[model samples]
Target: MDVVRSKDGTRIAYERRGSGPVVILVGGGLDDGSENEPLAAELARHFTTYNYARRGRGESGDTAPYALQREIEDIDALIGEAGRSSRLFGASSGGALALEAAASGLAVDSVAVYEVPYMADDAMVRHWAEYVDQLTVLLADGRHADAVELFMRLAGSSEEDVSGARSSSFWPGLEVLAPTLAYDAACLGDGQPPVGRLARITQPVLVATGGGPDPHLEGLRPSFFDEAADTIAAALPNAERRTIDGETHVADPQSFAAVLEHFFTSSGDFRQVSL
Candidate 1:
């Protein structure tokens, strides 16, 4: 893992691989950078990929009294190492971090984001604050497994699904990474989409949703993911949106990479459906 020091002097660990234009892959909630290795390999054939552990997880060192700007600085540090004007591809909440960075006036050339679930409603807002509070306390108390379980439940994992995950061998490993869940929540901002801030990003943005239409719903209506993709696309001045068929919120990396490649290597113009 290569080391880059954030402005606060936190040691951010990342793997640098392949060659060409630089691209940073940021993973979502409760994950270390390893999960991005596959995506990195696929994109590595084209771009030099910097797959980094967002601080507080994996090999990255964390500073105390976490703040959201620190995470942006971490990304900024990586961008500095990668020529200071490279594309970024972030998944889930990591996408939120990348967006926040671009909005904060970072030198990001472009950003391709998958499933940044910004909580944009009153009902979601009411419960979201409480969820963050509970998650923070759980991590503070070292209840890693409980924290992971809570996150899964909040993400709509069924009881059977949660139970099956616990019985699996991977559950324990995931529990070890569970403390970073709060970091993801914080990355999403203080429980709202920075609509104003996001609009300030003049760089080209690709906001996309995953998953095909529900087989039960007969593909007749838009899903929540589609709504989110549309809302973000509408808010951004230079943004395009798409929904990748058959890839859900968890995301399928190869499909996502294809979209990123197209967006990154284009003529700085994109098309999107008008709402």
Candidate 2:
């Protein structure tokens, strides 16, 4: 693992692999970089991939009073470490963070995101607001386990599965990462698509979704991911919308990596669909 010091002096840990154009993998909720290693390995075949533990997870050091910009600084540090502008692939809420980074005008060459977890309707927004409130309270009280379970339930975990997970040895590991859930929530403010902010990003973006239903979000709404993807694609000045057939919220890493490779290697002009 390699380390980079962010602007705020937080020590960010990441593993760099492969030998080509740089692509940084940003993992979403509860991810500690390990979850993204599979996708990173696949991308590494053609791109030099950096799989890093986000702040507050894995081997990365955390600072007090986390802000969304701090996470952006972390990405900037990684780009500096790569010694050039780099493309980014962010999963779930991490996707939102990547968009934010690009919008902030960092050294991002381009971006690709998978189901950024932004809600499409008032109902879903209200539901997410409740989750945010509950999460905040739980974390404030330091009820890490409850916070983790609450997040699991929000992600559409079955009661039985939640019970099993709570008893499993991995549950403790999850608890340690619970605090970052708030960080992801902050990335998707009010659970609405940040159209204005997204429009400001001039970099080429690939906004992707799965054609199949997302079981993790089934209880919330139908075609939620697709709707969010459409909104994002429309909002962006330069973007393309692609739906991966038979893939749900959890994408097939190999297939997703292929899509990314194609985009990253291209001239980044997706003229077919763009605002």
Candidate 3:
């Protein structure tokens, strides 16, 4: 893993692969670069892939008093390290970060985001804050599994499914990263009310959601995905929205790769081709 220091001196780690125009992939809560490893390998076929670990995960460093702006700076540091304008793909909370960075003028060639949870409604914002507080308490009690379950439940996951997944292979890692749940909550905030501050993004943007026709989890509403798409479409200067039919929050790599290829390869402004 290659390392770069962010503006606040936290070490950001990333792995570079393949050999073409650069495309940096950012993962969401509790996720390191490994979360997108499969997708990155697929993209590597056509672009130089930079699979980055957001601060505090993998080989990255974490300083006390973390701020959302520092996370944005981590991305900027990667773009600068790439030494050229690079395409960015962020998932969930990571998607929110990418949009924030682009709006802040990071010189990204293009941006692609999947299922970012943004809401403009005030009621939802208040509800989200309460939920965050609940999860924080769960984490404080060393109930990582319970915290994960609560988060999934808040995201609309059914109790049965959460229980079922608890014994699965994925749950352990998610529990391990449970404490960082606050980081994602901070990135998302109450209802993710428009950082009305983001209308400045001029780079071509692609906003996507899962079309699997199911809520993220049982009991949780699907408003997060809907509001996220609406927010990006309304705020970005040049943006397109797509729904990946039959896919959900946990998308298959092949489906994700195809969506990425269609957007990044066909977006003429970013990558020029020779016939």
Candidate 4:
């Protein structure tokens, strides 16, 4: 692992592999770079891939008074180490951060995101606010395990799944990184698609979603993800929407890598090619 110091002097750890054009993998909540390593390795076949632990997770360091800009700076630090420019692929809320980085005027060549976890309804907006409030209280009260459970359920974990996780050996490690859940919440401001903010992004973007049933949650509509991806794609000036069939909310790494390889390696034009 190599380390880069963010603007705040916090050490950020990353793993690099393969060669060609650079592509940085940004993972979502509960991810500490390990979750993205498989995808990175696959993409490494044709491109240089860097998978880094977001601040407060894995080998990365954290500073006091966390802010979303701090996380952006962390990505900036990684970009610097990557020779000051790179394409990005983000999963779930990490997709939100990647767009924020690109919109913030970072040197991003292109972007691809999978299931960025956004809602467009008033009820869901209230639900998201409640989640943020309860999560804050739980973390403040030192109920890290409960916070993790809450987060999992928010991500569509069933009762049985939550119980199984609680009994698993990994539960303790999850608790240790529970506070960073708030960082992800901050990344997903208002839990709705930020069309105004997203419109500023001029980089070519691939907004993708899965077309299969959510394996973890029964009765969940496939449109849940498609609509989110569509909303985001429409907001961006240079973007395309894609739906990968027979994949879940978290896509199979190989399938996703194939789509990304096509998009990232495209010849400047955001359209006309199949993915």
lDDT value for model 1: 0.82
Per-residue accuracy of model 4 over 1-275 as CA lDDT, tens digit each: 99999999999999999999999999999889888999999999999999999999999999989999999999899889989589999999999999998889899999999989888667767878999999999999999999999988877788888999999999999999899999999999989998998999988999988777886755344566677787898899999788787888778889889889988988565552223
Residue range with the least summed lDDT across 10 consecutive positions in model 3: 266-275
TM per candidate comes to 0.92, 0.95, 0.88, 0.96
* Model 1 weakest 10-residue run by lDDT: 213-222
Candidate 1 lDDT by residue in tens digits, 1-275: 88999999999999999999999988998788877888898889899999999998889999988888999999999989987588988887999999998899988889988877677676767677888889889988999888988887767676777888899998988997887787888887666778899899988898887666533233223465566677788888898887677876655668767777777888656777321
Model 3 stretches with alpha carbons more than 4 Å out? 120-122, 139-143, 214-216, 222-224, 267-275
- Name the candidate, 2 or 4, with the larger TM-score value: 4
After superposition of all CA atoms, the RMSD between model 3 and the true structure is 3.9
The prediction achieving the highest TM-score against the true structure is: 4
lDDT of each: 0.82, 0.90, 0.80, 0.88
Tens-digit per-residue lDDT, 1-275, candidate 2 = 99999999999999999999999999999999988898999999999999999999999999988999999999999999999999999999999999999999999989999988898888888999999999999999999999999998888777877898999999899999999999999898899999999999998999987778765555646677778998999999999888778887778889878888988998855754421
Measured on C-alpha atoms, candidate 3 has an lDDT of 0.80
Which residue pairs collide, candidate 1?
211-247, 212-246
**Candidate 1: where is the Cα deviation over 4 Å?**
213-222, 273-275
